[model samples]
Target: MPIYVQMARCCWIICFLVFSSLFRAYEASPGDSDQLYRACLSQCQKTSCVGARCFSCCNSASDGSPLDASWYNIKHLYFWWNHWDCQSNCRYHCMLYRENERAELGLEPVKYHGKWLSRRQYGFQEPISVAISALNLVMHFHGWRSFSNLIYYSLPLKPDKTPFYDYAGLFNIYGLLAMNAWFWSAAFHFREMDLTEKLEFSSFVALLGYSIILAIIRSFSLRTDAARVMVAAPIVAFATTHILFLCNYKMDYEWNTKVCIGMGIAQVASWSIWCGATEHPCRWKLRMVVVGGIFGVVVKMLDFPPYQGLVNSEVVLNASNIPLTYMWWNFIKDDAEFRTVNLLKKVR
Candidate 1:
């Protein structure tokens, strides 16, 4: 490899580490950490208002019966989608009240509990991300379908009536897992909570680890079953153990960040080196994916604030991956096409 390629690879790895830091450890945000905000929250929880802008849910009973005797309040759409109970309602409205006061003094909106203040952010928080996640899921499905059709339909099959691609089933599983991860991601963005958070993390981690394994298997040409298993067993084991550590032991964001960064860098390095060395027709396509991933990370690192109070850093990040998804599936189709033809030539 050229010196420049080596340097670029190193820098890419560093950027990936920074990417993991986007999942920062939970901390109080500027608005939430303010003295006045806390005071307002306390008062609101007690009295259910800061002047006239009151939320009836704030004074609801412990069992969720409305204290204000407003029948429609409990049936409100925000409560249905956001699951905002009395206390959370109090915290949210108080934050908004404080932000309004600050805005009156010509101050900009600040984050409360690690989120930018927005009226639409209440129900189905991170709506843009949720939509993008769903789109990613759809793209994954489409990619998987295209790849499968290219192999099983577009190309000739072996005597047993299967695709000539050695890892056809493996890539199939990869596609399914990719779709599953995005499904959970959409769910998590739609309604974030402990359960959804775990589902999202576990699904994503599993896909990440599986992707690394696929990279290893493909890069090293582990064609035989034993050879592939020899390379994949340890990685699968480690990924499973890490998931257990998070789900059963502790959901430590910092530790998870380290694990993800390490695995992500490994995955990126594997693909980068292979793409550099391979004479394969689709090599440049894979390179584009890697470079595009780096560019996406750069965009994410430029996090200023949500654009027009709608799109956030994460929204852009997910959107960037959408094109890459199409590219990847396209690459997979081309790979299948080339592999079946090339290998058949060797046999002849």
Candidate 2:
């Protein structure tokens, strides 16, 4: 044989040996034992093996018993379509069933056997699992669809006014609301209903409420230019951060954080620029930027336990300790978008 062929054969043998060793190790591992138990439980439930004992069969088999009740129960339940009550059986019966099934069939039962059998046997289960799956899929699709529509409609092709702007404005408003919904959901999930947590959560709700009121006022004030500018700032900032992350560019923490800080600076600068160009341009915008910068610096400086930096990096902060940071990002992005849209209208 050629030297290259000989080397290839050796490599193949080495790969096979490595895989075999790994498989053996996995089978011996404590974690794998827990996984096996979960797998067995899931399979038994799916097969509709009612009142079947599980633990006795596993233990008996481990002790080298001749009877394989677990295997029999699994096979029987797998073949027969039955009720959910099968899942609540005594551990001993299920174990015996498992042992019997294993002795007869020489293999463990499959997961989700009930659903698969139902589809094959009775055409489908009531409240068809497929329908539920489809509903979930459509919900995800709609979320992306809404995002795409917002992007397409919000940006002006030319500098002049057109119907596209109005459609885009509507889409953007809806998109912001949807984003708020996502944040609120996250807040609610984290809330423990404790007095302190409840108070913090309520503050988030208030912020969202105030944002909605501001949006409504802007819509009615005929200040679309200012609103466009405000809204655009956050959207652009966020989009920029997203693009960077997608392109694998390293930014400080996640894209959302960069966007939050960016939007805050941009909004203040836009206001300052506007003021400077107009009569009596005060230093309020500059002051706001300085204050925000100082606050960020202070946050970085004061690193308490659990509120300290993230484990992965020096600068990156732990998410659990920085609820306020997330709030800041959302608020900045929202305020910036609203202001940007309105500003654009002024220029137009």
Worst 10 residues of 2 by lDDT: 111-120
lDDT of 1 at 224: 89
Name the lDDT of candidate 2.
0.36
- lDDT tens readout by residue for model 2, 1-348: 753344334433543343234222111212223454456566655553324433222233344451556665676655333322233332223443444464488854321211111111142222232333233234433543544444456544445644323334544454455444344333322221233223323332333333333333332333456755654464445344454443353222222222333333433333333333333223343345335544553443342211111121112222222333333334333344455466578877
Over 4 Å off, model 2:
1-185, 188-256, 275-348
- In candidate 1, stretches whose alpha carbon ends up further than 4 angstroms from where it belongs are 1-44, 48-52, 58-83, 94-122, 225-234, 245-262, 301-303
lDDT of each: 0.77, 0.36
Q: Per-prediction TM-score, please?
A: 0.78, 0.23
As a whole number from 0 to 100, the lDDT of residue 320 in candidate 1 is: 87
Query: What is the Å distance of residue 286 in model 1 from its true position?
Result: 1.2
